[model samples]
Target: MPANTAPIKWAQRSDSLYVTISLPDVKSESITLTDDKLVFTGTSGANEYACDFEFFKGCDAEKSTYKVLPRSVQMFIVKAEEEEEEFWPRLLKDKAKEKNQVKIDWDKYVDEDEEEEAGGFDTSGLEGGQGMGGMPGMGGMGGPGGPGGGMGGMPPGMDMEALMAQMGGMGGMPGMGGEGGMGGMEEMMAKMKGDLENKGGDEGEDSDDDDLPDLEES
Candidate 1:
């Protein structure tokens, strides 16, 4: 049993988890989904790929659907009936032993929909201090042990690119000039060039008197 290279990524949301797999050259007919298992048989380049994964918890199979892309597949797994709206410790349960492999820790999962993050600052004490934004008033401004904290204090778990891609549409990237960052720059340059050309024409008109012949009366 050799190691696998299916390359799957997962992220948790308030109500669901998004799981994306690199499934290039996979036919829609070759994909299968069950209550707690996912199997895909496909080919990429000269190699044949067979990806199979069984979930630790049951999901709403009827609600869970996948979108096939040119090179991969994106799946949305609704929270299981028994699960609550909370952070998932890991994408999948550690079942390496079942597959005759050693168990390895994977990146922890985060809730994508929650804005009240503690920068992953772990704090647990008495009083009304055990909240997301850190101990009571000790939150905000991106500080430690509180919400709005920086990502440094937290363990690296999020697929930042994927998270941002999903968030990019919802939050809309700032300074992107509305869908066209460089296009905005091109528009500005074109306008500047047009203005310069108009200015040149104005200068030529102002100097038209200098080119006038003194033989106007002659």
Candidate 2:
């Protein structure tokens, strides 16, 4: 048969070889092969299917000879099936959850440490103005005589402006003498003018004194 016809099914029986092939749209026919090459004598279809059976070692129904087949032909017969699972994805999710938990615990520990460092000291039963050893602005038991006691001595309804002026003077700003502190830019300018006038008067007095020559009857 020619190469374009339908495929041929070869079956091997004890001492004979039987070949059955379907002809076009008609019935199939069985042919006996006496030699290695089998030739078709009658024509059944326009296309002919033929192949050389010299290498077809006989087909056995009970024993499969696929292992003895050529590597290229064996590759086309065996198929591999793959199995998929979600093992890695679940493990990754668990690891991420553990990491997030660790981060939360770390943040909580840092916040607790910050609070303890800020002002969480045990200061109960201690008088409001009493000194707590080595702590600045505190003094022993008796109230109001401590280092920061001025805050306790402010008189009722005291003028804030006067207090600030006193503080400014103690803070050392030029020209703001004693209790009259930092008298704005206008006050500083006025003081400067007065100083210049005094200096000018002193110079004038020195000039007049120079004009009054030496009283030595020269």
Candidate 3:
């Protein structure tokens, strides 16, 4: 499964670096921070998001902290050495990889469970003796409903199993999985995009406004 790519906004202060990523609905417990990297998974609107950052400047992960907001996450990372003065040219020291983890909410942060679950469909009304009435108006005859209700009038056969399986496959597509897998796809795309950009850079492509420039120690 591809991880969702999350866009980031960051700034450096004398004491710390503030890194924020748009994530309206994130799996809070999914957030992880270490001396070298940071990672998390989340969603916004109809799309999903994810991010993995490997820092160039060493950071004190123990002193770092983050807050999950209604639509974003704000993180603070303390400098490894208070006296050192330097700023990062880019958010990551190297190409990022999607290393995803548990996606439970803060309240259920300790639980090990699936991030998404199907609410389950209701078929009781859809399963009486009339049994689905042959594609709506096709209920030709036989029962009080007419030929549309008859056994011979019924379609060849309702392969519920096959149909359900096919539907499940569709649900697994991007933006489809009740809520899980689709979110990760964004991360995959983001990573691929980053790779392409880096490749172009390797080929001597000109840098643009989109590329972050080196910062002078202040």
Candidate 4:
């Protein structure tokens, strides 16, 4: 009997491709990689699992790496072209081949712009940049706050303006005020209070003016 074909999940960046085979506790693993093809065979207890892929573009097989985890085998294959900076439209040379067995790895997917931003923070010896590190979500969560110009770890969907209105004041959060201090919050709260008090005083003055209206015509 033939070995069972393993399921694969893949995602990619401009320079590399990620391939994961879902085979638990694989032993006697054999991986054959070339510029265009990858063949893998392994045994999990009595069951044999295998998979093969003909890549859409040339790859650097010698520089590629793989590790067998408790539940799967993960491969990181580097692209061959020195100037490659675009994602391949399809993973395989034959577009429809093994379509049912392969699927996108959405959790690992990063858009081109996000990848570039992540690349900018890469250190000399860091493996695959900070974005691709073990804590992948850290790159998307921007400096001291949420991603894409949010305030102080605020929930993405919360409307700050509405929230302040409900609370009956407009107060500046820390760091949102001038150069990071409690000063902004203090000023904002004071301004709100002063406005309310002044409005009441103006109403009282208007009532006094109404009582003295007899000299208005003179």
Q: Better model by TM-score, 2 or 4?
A: 4
Question: Which has the better lDDT: candidate 1, or candidate 4?
Answer: 4
The TM-score, computed over Cα atoms with residue i paired to residue i, of candidate 2 is 0.18
Top model number, lDDT: 4
lDDT tens readout by residue for model 1, 21-124: 66576562355666677676666656665667776666665555554566766565566766355665555555562344212223434434442571331222
Write the residue-wise lDDT of candidate 2 on 2-98 in tens digits.
4443333332222222233334432232232221223232234454343223212322222111111111111001011124211111111245432
What is the C-alpha local distance difference test score of each model?
0.52, 0.33, 0.53, 0.68
TM-score of 4: 0.52
* Candidate 2 Cα errors over 4 Å, as ranges: 1-6, 24-34, 41-43, 55-218
lDDT of 2 at 13: 21
lDDT of 4 by residue, 1-218 (tens): 99998888888888888878878898998887788998989998799988887988888765665667778877777778775468888788876774767888886777776887655212122222122212212233332322332555455566967656544343335465564344566577789999999999988778555677566665
TM-score of each: 0.41, 0.18, 0.40, 0.52
- Which of candidates 2 and 4 is the stronger one according to lDDT? 4
Number of the predicted model whose TM-score against the real structure is largest: 4
Pairs that collide in candidate 4 are none
Off by over 4 Å in 1: 1-5, 95-218
The alpha-carbon deviation from the true structure for residue 143 of candidate 4, after best TM-score superposition, in angstroms, is 32
